[model samples]
Target: MMYTVQSSGMLLKRFSANYVQNSTRLASFRQCERYGKFHDCRKRISHWLKAQGEQVAQACTKQCEFIIAQRIRRSLQIFHLYTRIWDEVALKEFMKSWRNRALRNSRHFLMSSIGITMYNWDRERITKDELNGYKKEIEGIYRLRDSTVVCAKCQLRIVIDVRQSGIKYCTCTDNKFNATSNQDSEGWKPYIEREDMLIWRREEPNCGGLFAYKVYGSFAEVTAEDFLQAQIDVDYRKEWDPTARELRIIDTDPASQSSADSHSDVIYWETIWPKLFANRDYVYQRDWVVDKERRLIIIISKVTDHPAAPSKPGTYRVTTYWSYMVIRPYTEFHQPGIEFGLTYFDDPGVNIPSAVTAWVAMTGLPNFLIRMREASRNYQNYKIAKQSLDASDTNYVPLKNEDIFEDKVLHGNMQNSERSEILNGKNVEDYNKIEHTEVPQFNEDLKEEEEEEDSTNSSEEGRGLLDYFYLAKLFA
Candidate 1:
């Protein structure tokens, strides 16, 4: 009986131990299953995030490409528009020049024929009269007291009156009328009066009855030298003169280079005109004489011909043009001032009404003088700036030579054909459009040097001890 009871106790203990072991194993399996499921979910989430990131990157790249394409298209459109406008302007100018040339040729032919016929008839009549003892005098007298002419017909004593004389002389030939010496000469009638300016007109007998104008004015607070420089500086004139389409010194007198007081230049000037009227251009010789003793400056300009400045298309060549100016210090006013007298006349190819001419002279001359005065006031500033720029740049060379009086310099080492092409507008380039090279500022360069030095010092200070040791070992 004792043996059987012991056996039963042992069985019960073994069963309890087995039950505890089974429970622990089941708990561990559950934990493992949970961990596996968690790991699987994390992998799926990572894959999804990576796919989303790739899609976003692709979209961003596409957007950048679209923006760049749009900008390129816009730039191309602007360039095409500019080219189209340029072509249209060039075409219009060409057509206008063609029409003008045709008209001029036809008119010239007709006038030449008429002039030849008339000249022959006049010559025959004059010869016949002289052979018949009817000689005429060259000078006509108003009264018999100064009569030098005698009529050989019927022994009649008659004086050739000035009014009835057939021979007429150009008013410009008169020795008594000097534009520079006399500001108020005979036959000058007061035409326009302003508070600070006066204009007078004298009828030119030979210039198609056009009036020669005299303008006298005083510029307050402007020195004579400044005013003179403003007038003569072509580069500065381009900034102020609205009427000037193109002005350049084509040639300068080599002879005048020997004398400092005397200077001369041949200039090509094209002026802007209204829509219907053709443009006018002038190839003129300008002579200026500076007298320091008298504090007087004289400038004279007249129409002249030049091989370098041939008449180009799209403009009318002004054949008859003259201008004279006298500038001196003004002592009449308390403040420093300049007094100027200018006389000018030009026969524009097309005839304009006298009233329009008078009106233009009255309004245009005063406004021009006013602008010139303003430019003179700014001339000193411009000179100083130019000097500074010149001093700062050692490699700078002027595009146009300063001493262009030499023939070789004026031609610019170009072939004759190339020069003609440029002058005739075939290969002409817009000089104003030429981009000026940006010069480095002295202050900016100094700042850059300072920044480089500071960066080097900072990098040296930022080195770690290990990095320094490595570098030192490498150097060693």
Candidate 2:
């Protein structure tokens, strides 16, 4: 009975140990399955968060693009509006100019008829032959409106056609002619010589046979472009020219007549006269051509009627006037300068002695040129200051110089036969055959008022009208 009881206790201890081992294994497997489910849930939540972030980033980029597009649309709309406003303004100005031009033409016609009648009626003072001769001379000058001239030095071709209201400059490289060989061929007589300047005179049969002067000289320190700017800068002229009593631009060429490389203006100039004589006023059309390749500039002015410059009471209106200037780059004394040829004539409507007139032409013209040269030298500084002021202003729209200096291929090369014909002067029609290349267009900016009241006042003290007339007493 004791042996059987011990065997039963051992069997009970073995069974309890096996049951404990099985329970620990089942508990560890349940813990591992729970850990795996938690990890899978965490991974799914992280993927959802990443997708939401990507969608938000895409939404922000679209919003920025939409805002930028809206700003560009708004800017384009403003630009179109401004363009329309400018177009309307330009139309109005054109109509007004047309009306004024018609009125002026009628007035000039009536005045000219009256003068012709008076001229014919006065037999004692002027004979019919004399009158006819004067008319012929005047017509001859008018014919120059459609003339061609070649530069003596460079053989550059220049065409002036006022009927077309245009001047054309062409390079004449193959054709050579010596235009300056015979000065007397053009009826020019050597009148005077001073320093390096040579003066020639051509007598007009009308107006008491007054002498018209032509001068050729070199400006020591000025460039051709600066000298040209000095001539055309009306405001700057007021500062330096003592003889000018009034100078203003009445009108500019209509847009139809203007081109990229050329400009024209109607200007009124009133010059001081001697003490006993009345002031002389001129209404003229001025045009200029700039040839960049040749470094040349040509300026021509002729009398024109304008309603804006009606005859003032005290001033003698000059009815017949013509002036032209040709300037080219020249080197003198190892320095680059300007060589100029100027021809000027006008009817002063007075009977001054020929000797006195000759003396004034010899002395006054040189003095005037000297002043112009000095003024041109100072213009560089003036331009810099003016540009600085304009740049500071918010409303200023700067005017761009025409891009005419760009290199261009010739329209068509002339054949050897054509060049020889031109040289022989047999093919006059081919002189203007070279067509200009189409220049790129730019928006025409509005011109600002160039003169200020303060500047006018400051310059008034030094500019005396009497200084020009002081020497007249010696001849009077």
Which ranges in model 2 have alpha carbons more than 4 Å from their true place?
1-183, 256-260, 331-336, 385-476
The ten-residue window of minimal lDDT in model 2 covers: 438-447
Model 1 lDDT, residue 154, Cα: 23
Per residue, candidate 2 scores C-alpha lDDT tens digits across 1-476 of 33444455456668766544366755665566556646778888899888899898999999999999999999999999999998999899998998888775765566576632111112212222422232222122212211224344444333211111111234463333322222454666555544334455777775687867766655545655556666777766776666677888766665414354456667898878756778888878776665444444566777777656789998888888777676654321112354566777777677767677666666555455444656766766766666634644321222223353322223213233332212111223321122432111111121133224323433553344323432211100
In candidate 1, which residue pairs get closer than 3 Å at backbone N, Cα or C atoms, i.e. clash?
A: none
Q: What is the lDDT of residue 375 in candidate 1?
A: 70
Evaluate model 2: give its lDDT. 0.52
lDDT of 2 at 35: 65
User: How good is model 2 by TM-score?
Assistant: 0.46
C-alpha TM-scores of all predictions: 0.43, 0.46
lDDT of each: 0.50, 0.52
Candidate 1 per-residue lDDT over residues 59-106, each given as its tens digit:
999999999999999999999999999999999999999889878565
lDDT of 1 at 372: 62
